[model samples]
Target: MSPTAAPTLRVERSLLRAGHGLVAGVDEVGRGALAGPVSVGVLVVGPHTPAAPRGLRDSKLLTPAAREALVPALRDWAAAWAVGHAEPAEIDALGITAALRLAGRRALAQLAEPPAAVLLDGSHDWLSDPPGQALPGLGEPVLPCAAPPVTTRVKADTTCAAVAGASVLAKTARDALMARRHEEHPHYGWAANKGYGAPEHLAAVAEHGRCSQHRLSWRLPAAALPPAPRGARAADTLQPPVGPGPGRGARGA
Candidate 1:
């Protein structure tokens, strides 16, 4: 693709022309994980025209280095941007869906100006909090915003520039945090899996058990096999059969 192409930004401009100013897109990462925090990112792009950043797509589709490189450019291109996270404890306490909503709300709340409407990258609504309800862990009350009642689409991240921008921000932020977690708990290989349950990660868990960073609510197998013991045989073992009681056996005596 040519560097000058701006298909994503073109879509962003179309939305602006359709009379939606202060349009913010919202997305979350790390929802399907046994460990690590669920992170939400909100990015508001105004009506002003500017060159779109290169290689913008669903954050999952981008490489780590590409996502990291796009983050600062997204921040600079966006009118406003913010990220918020719901840690493992919070996810366990409130559940992933609730935690996701809480994180998205917090991220949007951080914006300097409330958006006119929020475009979410999922079918389920993320902005459905009741009016006057307080955000968990934040002393501040949840302020009413003008986000759409219904989430737009499942693939809004790839289709909408604002959502793509939000995706990049959420993914990059979560990746950085997970990398730090890797330093503290080197066994889980979170730096590599980004908290996704890969085989290596499961092996690490089986060897080390769940760490504080892991969400224990996830129903991982209790008998996860760790690495084989040194010099252990690969063959199966046989057990002796139990004989009947003496008084009851032998044709009733």
Candidate 2:
């Protein structure tokens, strides 16, 4: 597709026509990273116009340059957009699943107008809150009486244009943050790996041990450690059985 060609933006329009005026798409990024925060972005598309760009797809499929290029266009075409994040501490404490929901809730709360309903990328199970438990750091009234229900689906990013837009925003925003972090800790090669547990990253861990930035909970297994050198048995050796006959008789019995 030509750089100038706008990507298709149909998902939100169809919902709008169906009487859902304030439909919003939600997506999160960095769920798999060993470090860094999880970011959730919420976006609402305005009335369909030729000015709206096309070429929407899962953010993973787009390059950094492509995503960067699309960000401004998305902001321009979108009726509204907001991003929320769960910090590394939160991810480490609450886990990725809970972090995702927290980020989503924060993002939605930032929106100027509450959406009639939310289109969350992936399954509804993702948003399952602990029954009657207040959301951490959100204070009392965790589930606002006025908030609308959310809808989620697998591959929602690809099938739903609004979700795709949210993906772009979340991915681009998280990428930028990772890039910034890369400047601070270049030794881990975070810029290239984006905090993923790549082989190089594992090697880095073995060489440097764990850093303050690393999630201590994700330490490499003992097998991942470098192999011991040949003929280097430790002085601590098990003594052989002194009474072999007794052992043999016991075994026979």
Pick out the ten consecutive residues of candidate 1 with the lowest summed lDDT. 244-253
Stretches of model 2 off by over 4 angstroms after superposition: 1-11, 46-52, 138-147, 219-253
- What lDDT tens digits, residue by residue, belong to model 1 across residues 1-253? 3323333755556667777777788888887777889898988888884655877777877788889889888899899999988888777766666677778777876788877777787777755665674446644454423345434666678777888889899988998999999999988888899887788787888888888898766556433445556776654222222211223111100
- lDDT per residue for candidate 2 within 1-253, as digits (tens), equals 4333333555566666777768788888877666677788888865553334565666877777888888998888778898878777666666566667777777777788877777777655444476784457744365422335677776777767678788999988887788898898877788888776777776776677666666544435443345556775743233232211221111100
- Candidate 1 matches the true fold with a TM-score of 0.78
Clashing pairs in 2: 6-53, 6-54, 7-53, 7-54, 7-55, 8-54, 8-55
Reference-based TM-score of each model: 0.78, 0.76
**Winner by TM-score:** 1
